[model samples]
Target: MSAESRPAIDGRIAELDDGQRRLLFDRRVGDAGEVADATRALLALVRSEGDDALFDFARRFDGVELDALEVPREKWGEALESLDSEVIDALTRAARNIETFHRAQLPSDVEVEVEPGVTLGRVFVPLEAVGVYAPGGRAAYPSSVLMGVVPARAAGVKEIVVCSPPGPDGMPSPVVLAAAAIGGATRLFAVGGAGAIGALAFGTGSIPRCAAVVGPGNRWVLEAKQQVAGEVIIDSPAGPSEVLVVAEEGCAQPAWLAAELIAQAEHDPDAAVAFVTTSPSLLEAVRRELRIGVAATPRREVVAEALSTRGALLLAADHDEMMTFAEAYAGEHVVLCTRDPRADRAGMRTPGTVFLGGASSVAFGDYMTGANHVLPTAGTARSFSGLSALDFLRSYTWQELTAEGAAGMAGPVATLAEAEGLPGHATAARLRGSKAGEETS
Candidate 1:
């Protein structure tokens, strides 16, 4: 295949020019100034107008007129009954796995005595309510319903509210509703986009406000999350989906590798995919296979657009270079198709999730691997993490000091407070010291 005709850029990572480097590392989600302004306006409208704003947005963005935002409680059961038995069974099994996995992630309360007469401890408290946004734009993500709600349920959250876009029938996909039922969602709403996010954050008359919103969506959803970050907690600023695969010369099959790239690319036109290898022959082979795979996929237009714009085939100088590049990129999903994946994975510390070996496709992780797929995108994996049960739990520390301990800490506290020009704090600390002394005397 000619280089010009290939979907992705082929180059050595060390030799990448300015444009190639920017394409690989500067792939941040493009939330333009206009988009941000629009998101702020939408959120403010929802905050002030409540359900009326949501109804208007539904007509304008979703092209649907809605009498109600919340789906009837009985509709969840009805949706489950309407689904195929196989789908119901699959959702049930996935929910079980997800619950089991998140249950294990539930943290134990911790108490410690670090010094004499000073006891410090922390307790995990589940949020009273949480909103889980399942995207219904390009596809209905029943799996996302399980990924978001099951973990919150396992974390002991009382109100697991699900929000998904309504289809032309003026309801979320039946499969999504079925999954919500299986995942034990307390409430479900047929609202979507920035409007849904706003309603969840600020509370409409019909939709209850959530303490935290957890899930993934398009740029508009991400922008809305940013605008309301101070009003409520968000999982992270999600961007387009991304994946990176690192393969050893003989460890990965070209066909399998191509399939993995296509899987991620098909997500959106901006979703990024990359293949890094030290072997020139393997890179060429995978490039050819990618061409073949993209040609036959149903979402070929999206896949091709993503690949042509953001995809890359990187030739690393050696194992060390390959590992370094993968860690630096901090892909949302990293697949180690190496001779010794276990050994190679030890060097990786930043990827949102890692799949060991060629057989461990990212698709499994996306669906039923019992791992949450709402991960940090772009390079945010460098600091953020995949959604987990902990996202639904908040921790606060408490400290108790005996009089002696208080007296001991008072001098230093007063010194620091006075140095920082907080006379009130210093006076309070000195009073504590004096009171302790008086009691001891």
Candidate 2:
């Protein structure tokens, strides 16, 4: 299909026609029953068979016969030594920025007195172990390694485990190893897909079980994560990569807007991209620029498929309509190419990450911007958040009360407990109240 023939919705999003609404909002990431069943079987096999299951799956799925599952600690140093100086420098610098950013996210314990002699507070505790899964099927995401590991390390996680699908040589990409080392992963495993998640969730003899598993991957990885959710904490279910570019006339160059859309579209065939604007001329110019940009890209087929299917060109009636639609869409990446991007961002509510101005490219955020790239997708930005140091930490609240505070709370507590028909709870509160009153008297 031609670029002009791609999906387009015009008018106020609130008053969209049935077909237009469906086009704009019906992009649900439905679960494939077959995929779920396969993932369940894979997880069961990994749980029942352990290392043998990993080897079998490695050969069956990854097409590599692995002699061992865990990549040796020594190989990380060797990988760094073998890599080009430029690649090493880039990974090292990116790791540094990522650590610096997440270190700032480390939360402090909060305490406050709600009333006289009554204190309540929450303390943050880091998980002891975490699993970072770097996808190696479609591409080597060394950046994902940093995104997952650096945050956990900064949050004070002691055992940061890394897992990735083995390459043709039966090991993860050397760049991944180097990133793991730079990010301070304590262990590395050459495994991937549902099986890798299973190993991390269930803990085989070779790969230690983790308290949480994170990083983005294909559908199999997502399905596996969902199945093992209660066993270990998983990040938000990642859907196809997506971005929404909200622009105004003359605010951003048409080529720059088109490039942003194409950059997100190139991620996968199912990835979604949309350009929303109030200016008809700007929309047309972006359509034209997309035609040129899509033709020039090496990933032309993937970009074209994405743009033709899930991509959209939405023309809103006004700035209010544009921003309303943007908030409703709640896209994973929202780029505001408006006159005042900051003001526009301040009014918005549900964007995984908002890139301000034409100069703030999503590509920069994906790599060296120090902001984590692992973000909620499939409209999940409405409630979910991007992966961060906070995800690796659990918080618990504590309460301390003086005798007077206990006596003050007891009457209300006992009354509520009696109203709820829990006589035992009422008696417990009354007994505490009596003891505290007597002590204070």
Q: Give TM per candidate.
A: 0.94, 0.93
**RMSD of candidate 1 to true structure, Å:** 2.2
- For model 2, the run of ten residues with the poorest summed lDDT: 3-12
Candidate 1 Cα deviation (angstroms), residue 178? 0.6
The true-versus-predicted C-alpha distance at residue 256 of model 2, in Å, is: 1.3
For residues 22-119, what per-residue lDDT tens digits would candidate 1 score against the true structure? 77887875556778898889988999999999889888988899988899978988998899999998888888888888899899999998888779
Task: Provide backbone clash counts, one per model.
Answer: 0, 0
Model 1 lDDT vs. the true structure? 0.89
Which sections of candidate 2 miss by over 4 Å? Answer: 1-20, 29-31, 435-441
Tens digits of per-residue lDDT for model 2 on 1-441?
A: 365435454334556687766655656544568889988999999999998999999999999988999999899999999999999898888988998998998889999999987899999999989999998876799999999999999999999999999999999999999999998999999999999999998999999999999998877888898899989998887767899999999888999999999998888777878889999899889988888888788888888878777888888889998999899888989999999999999998889999999999999999888999998887878888899999899999999987777777888999999999999998877766797564854
Q: What's the C-alpha lDDT at position 405 in model 2?
A: 78
Error of model 2, residue 24, in angstroms: 3.2
